[model samples]
Target: MKQLSLNDIQAAAARLRGKAVVTPLLSNIELNRRAEAEIYIKPENLQHIGAFKFRGAYNRLSQFSEQQRQAGAVAFSSGNHAQGVALAAKMLGMPATIVMPKDAPAVKVAGTKSLGAEIRFYDRWQESREEIAQDISEQTGKVVVPAYDDLDIMAGQGTCGLECVEQLQEMGMTAEVFLCPVGGGGLIAGLSTAVKALVPSVKVLGVEPDLFDDHLHSKKAGSRQKIEGTPESICDALLAPMPGKLTWSVNSRTVDEFLSVTDAEVEEAVRFAFRYLKLVVEPGGAVALAALLSG
Candidate 1:
């Protein structure tokens, strides 16, 4: 496995300059007072497809050889990554096929289809998305766009951290810590790497639903730890079974700690964001904020 570096993230940022949205770091006076700390929200919800998944998707899809792009791309995701790849392929003028859970949010499924991608639904509990994507790629001879385990995908995600640092620097301020929701560990893994490189003292914290703390358990075990039984949460996007191998390699070193929030706490955070910050955050996206509110 290759190690990701600042250079790799910098390269991805260059590629995404005109293509990806530079989401803003928004602040709310009430939120600061409530948390008793200045909390800056890097709203990747403003990104294409309403998530940071677009950053990695566009970065990887746009790098494919012309022949590969024309042949098309295949990916598997419960929601966000599906829409990311679907929308990116459309922007790059390529065909896209996504393997998604039958129980995925209606809005996300509709969003992917809205981008003109073919959808393949599967049983989320009984089936393997990776296996389905592999079969599709073999049948169609299209490249598989991995959700987060790919080198390019992680590097692409690192661009978000790079932007956060630059955005704070421009305001003549420095962050004491950075918090992000952890699913397969892609976003936090890549973002933590970049943030640590730029500001060594800034602690990077990864948050997940208490029932789905794969990263937390993995950190304690010193290896990848898969969730054993059925665990449930309203944060559907944070339910990845385990941290990706590629992402864990970086996260093990870059992240300072993992924090777990209950489903009720996450729900409350979502409500708080809408009421106080006027931001409609998805449950998974609100876990980090939930942790802050917990204390």
Candidate 2:
């Protein structure tokens, strides 16, 4: 298990300065009244490409060498990561090729294409995205940018946690519990590492759709576990078949627990975000809030 230190997160934060959005932690009076705790929401849905993934993608992409940048890069994602990589590459003036599922949200696909990346679609159930990405990399000599399996990506994602802590302190508060959605576990793994180091008592929990609870099961089993059947979740961004080996290494040590929410609960949470919070969160991005609300 590779361990990510606090230094790594700080370095990532430094690198992301003036690049990534310092997403505000929003506090609603009604939300706090209902939760019985001071509930603050980190609205990454407003992030570049409408998700937190841009943090890691830009972090990783910016570090590419001049040669690597010229060769271009390839990534595999259903939606969020695709847009992340595409936008990051565009910002860096590098060509990007993204392998995405054919059924991915049209909005996301259009978002990626709008960023000047070439799109290659594959069947979600019938084809392996990794294989397709690998083939593209081999043929074009483009480097494959993994969505969640690499340490740099995890460190970049850790910037979110670092920001959360800084923002909380500025507001004269400390988080007792930090909830975040988990798919391949990079987001939670990075967040857990940073939060635990900054505030040891803060509990960092990973939330996932009930049908795609590989992280939940893996945490309980004390090993990385892959789902047996097709992951049938409405949260397209949270449907990784299993947690990444590297992400699991960090998550297994830093994350305190895991939570699972149903699709119905997620839909209601999305509605809640829209109706009350005036935020538009996709199904996957709402899972953590769903878990927090159901509690």
Candidate 3:
């Protein structure tokens, strides 16, 4: 059982200094009016690789020894994490191989390839991406960088929460709630850990795609639960099959509740971000906001 402390998150913040992008906490009066609450959004879309995954990817890979760096790294993701690992490896001057679903968005595939990572496509419906990554690791002797299941990765993701808390304090305000998007639960797990430690009273909420509500089910069951079948949804990044074991350990304790958003709601949220917030966001990136706006 690996327990994460605020110190771990702080240490990650220290490591990410001058490395990770410090995305802003943006709010719109229109959004506040609709949600009936002063909602602040941390838009990781501005982060490198166009997602928050880069923070964890770089945090985990940067700690590799000289020998490990030389040997290279491997990882599996639908899209965002693949791009994150590829870009991080490129920045660190290490070779990378990414196992990605065949149906992963084309733009993300091109982004990963542009970073010079070797891409292996798998059938998400028929093949196990974890097994593929393990086989690649065994054969190539590359370090397997799991997207969300590692301690360093979670700690790295926690930096997002750390920044949010600090930014709020700087604004002379305290948040009453935090809504985070969840796939395999890395972001929310680390985020909840930081928020719970810094502001104990804030309600930490996890939002998932309605078609893929594994987190909601897992919370109700008091254990990790897997979604069956490949349900179609516009939120491709949120199609993760199950909650990560280590991520669940932290999420079960720190997360206060879980919410699910529909594809239509996510589309609306994306439009809102562009029209009002003046930011471009993907469907998965907007689900947490979607939950709030839909209410």
Candidate 4:
């Protein structure tokens, strides 16, 4: 698998200019006081489709050639990436079809449908989303837009890190440590690549649901780790069974450490964000903050 570079993220930043929202780095006074460190939160739950998935979606979909764009695109995601691809395809005037698990959140399903994408549901345990997407691509001639495995997708996710660094720099602050939720490791891989490149001394950490700690295990083993058993978590978006091959290649080199948080911790973080920060964070989206608070 090919590894992503800082330049890849830089180019992605350029592509996302004026397209993706530069989400704010939020700070809570009470939390800061308690933590004894300035905790700057990149509230990506405020991002388009209510997560950072839009960055990678737009970056990949926008790069499709006229023919491919016209032919359309197919993707699979539990939720956030489905909405991301759907919305991006809609904005770019391309048809989109998403393969989603039947048990995905209703709000997320409605969100994706609202963006005018065709939805296909499957039993996540009994079926392979990638195969479904590929089947659809073959039948319709639409390009398969991978949720996190593609280079462009990884690079696009990296833009979040770039924006974080820029936002911090604007505040005359430098990150001592940076944390982000990890699923297939795409976001962390991209974000770590950019954060490490721009702020070399800053530690980049990935947070995962304790039940689905493939990235964490992989980091410990110094290699890819295929998780066993049926993993369950409220953080649906962070339940990817293992890191993407492409993403792991980058993450293994760039990220400093992996942290795993329990569902209860994530719930607490979500409640805290709502009560104090006035921010609504999904279970997966709040894992990094959960780690920061509990770790």
Candidate 5:
């Protein structure tokens, strides 16, 4: 896998310009007061696909060659990435096939299909989506647009962190710390790289659900760790068994620390965002705020 560099991030920002939404950097007085520190929320919940996944997905698909674009695209995602790829491919006039777990949220599945992507459901307990995706690729001759492991996707995801730093500069404020939820580790890896590159003094922290803290364990062990059993957490988006090899490589070097939060804390944070911020944040999306609150 190729390393996502600063130049790649810059190119991603340019490629995604006018294609992806530049989500607002919001500061809640209540959260700042409660955390006893300056807090800024990059409201990715308001993004086109309702999450930051769109940044990476769009960036990756937008760079596809004419032959690849004509051949279509395939990806395996539980939720957000499915919607992101579906929407991006639709916008670019390319066909997309998404393989999702049968137990994935109905809202996400419906949203992805609404964008005209072909949906295939697999049993997470019995089948490997990676193998299924590869089979689909072989059968359909579609290019596999991986969710996190690809260099283009990582560069695209880094655009979020780039926007965060730019927003801080515009506000005449700088963050001492940056926190993001970790799953397959793409978002955190991309964000940490961008944050540390732009604001070298800022601390980049990855927040993981206690039941699915593979990134935390992997970092400590100096290798990727896979969870054998089912994840018991309500943060469905953070339940990846282990970080992607490419994402882990970037994160192992860029991220400053890791923090784990309980399922109940994630639930409360999601509820709080919905009630107070009027944002329908998924449990995984609210993990960063959960960490700040718990601390």
Candidate 6:
């Protein structure tokens, strides 16, 4: 896999400017009181489509050539990426077809449908979304946009890190550690690269559900690890069996640590976010907070 350079990240930041929201990095007083360390929440939940996926989705779609854009785009995602791609494709006036698990969250499915993307559903454990997506691509000649593995997507996610660093500077604060939940690794890979580039002193950490901790094992084994079988955690979004090759390369170099949290911990964090933060963070989205609060 080709490595993402600082130039790529900078270009992505430029491409995403004025498109993706520059989400706030607010200190969680309750969290800080408990952790005994100054803790800030990067409320990417407020991002367009209600997740950080918009940065990468818009960045990738916007860079497509006219011909490619005209051909339209297709991708496979469980939830967040689906919504991101759907919204981005709508904004770009390109047709989108999202292959999602049949059991994907109702809100996510509704959100994607609301964005006017055609939905294709398959069994989460028994179906291969890649094959289904390829079939759709062959039939419709749509461009296959990967959820996390692509360089363009990774570069787009780097914009989030850039925003975080800027927010920290403006607040006259520095994060001792930056934690993000990892799945296919796009978000953490981009965030870690940008954070290390801009704030070398800060530690970039990737949090994962213990049931699907391929990233943790991969880092330890010095090779990519793939786990077979369905994830047994409530953090369904972190269920990718292996890290993307491009994501692994970036994360292996720039990420400071990998931490695993239990299903129970994830659930607690989700409830906490809803109860205290008044944020409806899904289980996968709450893993970072799970690590922070449980540690």
Better of 2 and 3 by lDDT: 3
Per-residue lDDT of candidate 3, residues 83-199 (tens digit): 999988999999999999998999999999999999999999999888999999999989999989998999999999999999999999999999999998999988999988999
lDDT of 6 at 157: 86
Write candidate 6's Cα lDDT for 108-206 as tens digits.
899999999999999877889999999999999888888899988998888888888888888887767889999999999888888888878999889
Candidate 1 segments whose C-alpha is farther than 4 A from its true place: none
lDDT (10s digit) by residue, model 4, range 200-236: 9999889999999998899889989977989789999
What TM-score does structure 5 among the candidates reach? 0.98
- Where does candidate 1 have its weakest 10-residue lDDT segment? 227-236
- Error of model 2, residue 259, in angstroms: 0.7
Q: What is the lDDT of residue 195 in candidate 5?
A: 84
Backbone N/Cα/C clashes per model: 0, 0, 0, 0, 0, 0
For residues 150-259, write the lDDT of model 1, one tens digit per residue. Answer: 88898899999999999999999899999899999988878988988999999999999999999999999999999888878899898998899999998999998999
Model 6 scores what on Cα lDDT?
Answer: 0.88
| Stronger candidate by TM-score (2 vs 6) | 2
TM-score of 3: 0.98
Scanning candidate 2 in windows of ten residues, the lowest lDDT window is 1-10
- Model 3 bad stretches (over 4 Å): none
For every model shown, what is its TM-score relative to the native structure?
0.98, 0.98, 0.98, 0.98, 0.98, 0.96
Better of 1 and 2 by TM-score: 1
**Per-residue lDDT of model 5, residues 1-295, tens digit only:** 5777888898999999998899988878788788898788998988898888998999988988999899889999999999999999999999999999999999999999999999999998899999999999999889898888888898888998999999899989877899999999888888888888888899999999998899889889998999888767888888898889999989999988899999889888988788777888989899999998888
- For lDDT, candidate 3 versus 4, the one ahead is 3
